[model samples]
Target: MEHSIFVMCILAVLSIALANPIFQDFSQLKAVENANKVLQLVDQEVLSNHKLGQQSSLPQKIDWREKGYVTNVKDQGQCASCWAFASAATMEGQLFNKTNNLITLSEQNLLDCAKSYNDKGCAGGWMSHAFKYIRDNGIEADGTYPYTATKQECSFNEANSVGTLQNYVKLTKTTEEEILKAVANHGPVGVYVYMSSLFMGYKSGIFEDDSCTETPNHAVTVVGYVNTPQDQYWIIKNSFSKSWGEDGYMRMKMNKNVCGITYRLYYPIV
Candidate 1:
């Protein structure tokens, strides 16, 4: 009976793993033309014209999670608020590094208040624009404003703000080395990437979807990186809840410009 119970426990764990959507096979997942319409709102000209500084040297391995800058994974639900989440996460890291206090900021604040900067809230938005809003008006704490995962009227109150950005700097486009240096020296970075069907179903291992396009449609935070002799990858923190890839995180193949991860990366200066 004891042996049988052990087998049953193992089976239960396997059952739970199989039930996760990320485990589903995506071999037949077709690439959709409009799969990334939300990212089309980004003003490429502004990003391109932005000046970049010299690259700093980066360590072979760095993890912000171990350094205590990363916040808990968040769930955006059905909202296309990846841009807001990414912006807030990067700010949280910067704030923590500055004050040694890890406070969760409100993505809803950006969703509602940053529309003046051309953000469409849950419909779609740009991280660069969100940073501009934060720099100008400041961002409230999650406890003050909170995330509703839906479009709401602006209820911004600067008095309740927990963080503010002095400025934001864009990294050199298509330069993976520069991006690595930025993440290593700074805390986390806000970056855009193509959200392919395979990416949606990613569970584990280094994600290197060849079907991914250069068009970035979703924003996420790059918290760290790993360099193995065989494979190198970027540690990405997603806002899709802890149930997704490696507890709402993903590692994509590094230095290949996978899914335009290196195209437009920016970080806040607090």
Candidate 2:
């Protein structure tokens, strides 16, 4: 009787094991995990509202003088100052577009000083939190200070803060062209994109596919836009080390919310 009971238990365990779901690869598993976030944005109502068509591409002949400036991020190495570098670049572009003179804000300052929101300096951070920091404490000029990607002592004088938080304009819900026109006409726009793996260290090309063949990791800035006859693209500047691609600059397809720009809830400094 005891032997019969043991055999029945083994059979039940084998049945359970065979019934479990088997995932082929990390991509499929990730898809399952990200499904909620995807549907939240890609649903019919939201997708139809974006009007993702009318946006322009990164012009083939990039007239830097007329379009705007494209700059690089000082190599931050393995540090987590990516958030600081990204935030500073967006703000820097905005300031540059407005004054017509480049301003290198202190990425080091944000890395060292911004501690309230659990931001791990070079580790990672959210654009919204970075903006909140700028709003609460005005940023300083690059000359007024310099960048130190590592967690260093905050030695800069507080009184040197240049612009106030009120200078930034936040957009709740708007179209891509509205944002691009804002950047072209007003200044740089701080956009939060769903960066995909293909975009990483991307050198040069007009991206069109959304296969997400790669995973989306960090966040970056849409400093400028371009409209080529072939395709529309966003001129993005990254905080990764210059060794990445084209000294940390790349072009992303404007189709299918490339980098998820359509769902972008952006803020800018006018």
Candidate 3:
């Protein structure tokens, strides 16, 4: 009951946030060609109204960890492989959704093997490409491959493969409201956001960086959202270890895309 109310308020905040230049109309998007490729995973009729209506009544306030699902806080450690960690986390969530088994997958497998798929290992990568790699060649279990926090030779064995990824879906529309809908209906999702220096030392607070750039430079998973009139934000599960932010999670304000949180939104189809 409390969670329902919390999400209702956050979605209210995000609805206003949809007007950010980053979430502008399709024609203005630099990636307009790609923006045209929106998958219809959610029914448009059910969500015709973004701010108010029956659809708006069901606010999603999800926290997989609070519901018996356990996803350990992983540390990428000195590596620019945040994309791998984000992808791994999304895949883990989708795996749990399909079979009710939440097994941690390997970020190292992607760091090494996905090079052929255009991933630069620790140098950097895109979550969309990482999802493609998982769809084509299944990922290895963390127990089998383990994270080295650095790029290494591809020693991925099919015998150690954990969950299967069917494909990945991009949001039909990029809006904070749409992001909320996805997280509420679907599980956790991978997002692209520009991380400013201000976020480097984020401790405890609702992050809203006015100096944040429009371009996205980092990848992370959005686990949930919450609001209490004054506090409305997205709970991001980063790969910066438990020592960072609120126990490895950062609360970014909803009405502002400080980190370009609504730029690239995608979830795995397990």
- Which prediction has the highest TM-score against the true structure? 1
- Which 10-residue window of candidate 1 scores lowest in summed lDDT? 27-36
* Candidate 2 whole-model C-alpha lDDT, 0 to 1: 0.54
- What order do candidates take by TM-score, descending? 1, 3, 2
Q: What is the lDDT of residue 156 in candidate 2?
A: 48
Candidate 1 wrong stretches, greater than 4 Å: 1-57
Q: Write the per-residue lDDT of candidate 1 for residues 97-123, one digit (tens) a residue.
A: 989999999999998999889888776
lDDT tens digits by residue: candidate 2, 172-246: 445676656655554445555543434532556765556543223245666666765666777666666665556
Question: Which is the winner by lDDT between candidate 1 and candidate 3?
Answer: 1
Could you give candidate 3's per-residue lDDT for residues 11-31 as a string of tens digits? 432443364533222112112
Model 2 Cα RMSD, 1 decimal: 11.6
Please give the CA lDDT of all the candidate structures: 0.77, 0.54, 0.71
